[model samples]
Target: MQNVLQYLPQLLGAAFKYTIPIAVISFVIGIVIALITALIRISNKRGVMLVVKAIFRFYVWIFRTTPLLVQLFIVYFGLPYLKIAGIAPDGIKLVPFTAGILTFSLNTGAYCSETIRAAIIAIPKGQWEAASTLGMTRRQALQRIILPQALRTSVPPLANSFISLVKDTSLAASITIIELFEVSQQIAAANFQPLLMYSLVALIYAVFCTVLTFIQGYLEKITSRYTIA
Candidate 1:
């Protein structure tokens, strides 16, 4: 018990430094990518929209169907082999932190795009017609009316995605990123107490997830007040 207490601060501090940053940065980038993909999917142009739909569908399918650990391995370990085969002048060689961010961002984007699309679609068709009757262009209608309402509906799903992302960042340890779980592993290795160290790690993750859940509920309430029945 004393040994676990002694190492708790170090493990928690390391997690705050490494894990939080990776989750925040990756989720931010992921949100941007998701918004763009959702917009592309809804575009009215026939030829361009068809091409984008095919590409976006394939991207989402691959990322959603595969395991994240395999994706991390491909980014961190497999991509560098291109240089060995002389396929390119310079093969990609990403450090663990960079690799973790890239993999998480792409994976999150693929999943979140569907949530965003559904939110946008759920808005009533009459809302668009009402905006057009007021002499608003399509862009203005979306910006002034459609998007604001869609954003409210999107909150729950997007918050859930963010919470899932917080847990997923632990996978960064697989690529040697040295986040919370990795720190726990190192401590366990030296003290020969894997069970205790891992228990602490799980506890910390639960606390973080719990706090996010509270925030999600609060946001949902606030948005609900503004939503039309």
Candidate 2:
């Protein structure tokens, strides 16, 4: 306990340095991908719908089926093999950070797409009709009316995704990325105090996730005001 307290600042500082960028960038890009996939999942055109659905289905299948560590290894260390033979004579210089972002983003995108699709569908058809009557196109109605409501309904799930991503960032360490968990591992190895060091790591994650929960709750409260009864 005393040793953990002594090393808390160092562990936390390293953890923050590694986790924050991975979480934020992955969440943002993952949300964007999920939004596009959700739109495809809901679209009406046969050609557009078929292609998008196929793409997303394959994408989600591949990512969800594999362990995240395998994904990171392939992206960070395996891509430059036969896949990119002509593109560059040299192998890909896969950075750990880039690998971390790619893995986290793709992983989160699959789950969040379903969350987003459900949210959009949950919106009332009356809202769409109201928007059309007010001189809005389908796109406009989706942008101005349906999406806003969907966002409110989507908050809790989206928050869960973000929280998961935060913890998942620790997997970056497996690929030589010096994230919080990796730092904890190194400290534990040196001090031979695995239990104490990991407890601190868990505490840090809990604190961050708790803060996100509060923010999500507050946002949900605000968004509820605008939700159609």
Candidate 3:
């Protein structure tokens, strides 16, 4: 207990340093991949749409069905076994940070793809007709008219996903990345005060998620003005 209290600052600082990058990078890359996936899902070409849907569906099925911890293990541990023989070289394996970023990004992308696809589909047919009447091509209408509205519609869900990613970052610790929960675990193990350390970690996560909730509400209010519904 005394040791945990004494080292609180160091523990917290290390945790935040390790966790923030995972959350931010994952969210950004995930959103971009999701947007592209959504665009493909909504395209007029049947072949393109089918391919995109299959990719997204498979991604979502795999990630959602498997435990995230196992996924991280495969990325950090299993990949080395399948590396390109001696060409890949030793010590060039995925680092904890790389594993955190890659796994989180892929996991978030699976969910975000669905949210984005729904948003794009929800765009009003009249909006498309209006854009075409103005001499816009389908691609131009999607880019100029449909996507913006879909983005607004997607905001709340995207915010929720960001919040979830922020908390899930603790899973990175399982791969030896010293994220919040991992730091707390170390503190508790050293001091024999697991309850106190874990409680603090939980509190920190709750506060962060709470802030995200407020931001989501504010964005929803601002975007509501532009919403077709």
Candidate 4:
């Protein structure tokens, strides 16, 4: 009990410094990637775009189908060996933090792209037509009208994804990132109280996720208000 209290700050500190930051940064980047991918995949043009769409589809498929841990290992460990000649004779090598961010962003983006795409598709075709009738270009319709509605509908799922991402940041420990879970592991090793330390960490994660859940509810309420007649 005394030891746990003593080390509580350290555990929280790790979360503030590494865990939260990693998740926030990764999720932000992931959202951008997801929005772009979703937009591109749904675009009507089909010239060179066919090639681009296929590439994005394969990327999403590969990330969604593979284990995240394997993805981390590939980014952090395997990439260093793939020599790239002039681009990089020694291949691509990323620091632990960079590797974690890269993997998490891409993985989350792949999943969130599907979520966003579904949300966009859920918008009524009449909505698009309405925007067009207002003398709006497709780009203007998407930017000014379509995306706002999609965002409202997508908020819950996207928030859920963000919460899951917060928990998943613990996996950064596997690659020597020394995040929240790793901090707990280190303390447990020292105190020889693995059960207590693990439980404590889990509680922290639950707390963080609970806060996110509340935020999700709040957002859902706000977004749904205009729909309620």
Judged by TM-score relative to the true structure, which candidate is superior, 3 or 4? 4
Q: Write the per-residue lDDT of candidate 3 for residues 69-159, one digit (tens) a residue.
A: 8999999988777646568755347888998899999888888988999998898899999999999999999889988888888998899
Q: What is the TM-score of each candidate against the true structure?
A: 0.93, 0.92, 0.89, 0.97
Residue 226, candidate 3: Cα error in Å is 3.5
Q: Comparing 1 and 4 by TM-score, which wins?
A: 4
Show how many residue pairs clash in every candidate, following the order shown.
0, 0, 0, 0
Better of 1 and 3 by TM-score: 1
Candidate lDDT scores, in order, read 0.89, 0.87, 0.84, 0.95
Q: Candidate 2 on 1-229: residue-level lDDT in tens?
A: 7867898888789867888889999999999989998888788778667977888888877887898889888888787663556676687766788878888998899889989999999888899889999999879998989998899889999999999899888888888988888889998999999988999889999998999999998988998985547
**Which residue pairs collide, candidate 4?**
none
TM-score of 1: 0.93
Candidate 2 local lDDT, residue 208: 88
User: Which pairs, if any, clash in model 1?
Assistant: none
Using TM-score as the measure, name the better of candidate 2 and candidate 4: 4
- Which stretches of candidate 2 lie above 4 Å from their native place? 89-91, 227-229
The number of the candidate with the highest TM-score is 4
Best-matching candidate per lDDT: 4
- Model 3's lDDT to the true fold? 0.84
Q: By lDDT, is 3 or 4 better?
A: 4
C-alpha lDDT (0 to 100) for residue 122 of candidate 1: 94
Model 4 lDDT per residue over 1-229, tens place: 7778788899999999999999999999999999999999999998999999999999999999999999999999999998998998988999999999999999999999999999999999999999999999999999999999999999999998999999999989999998999999999999999998999999999999999999899999998899989
User: Which RMSD values do the candidates have, in order?
Assistant: 2.1, 1.9, 2.7, 1.0
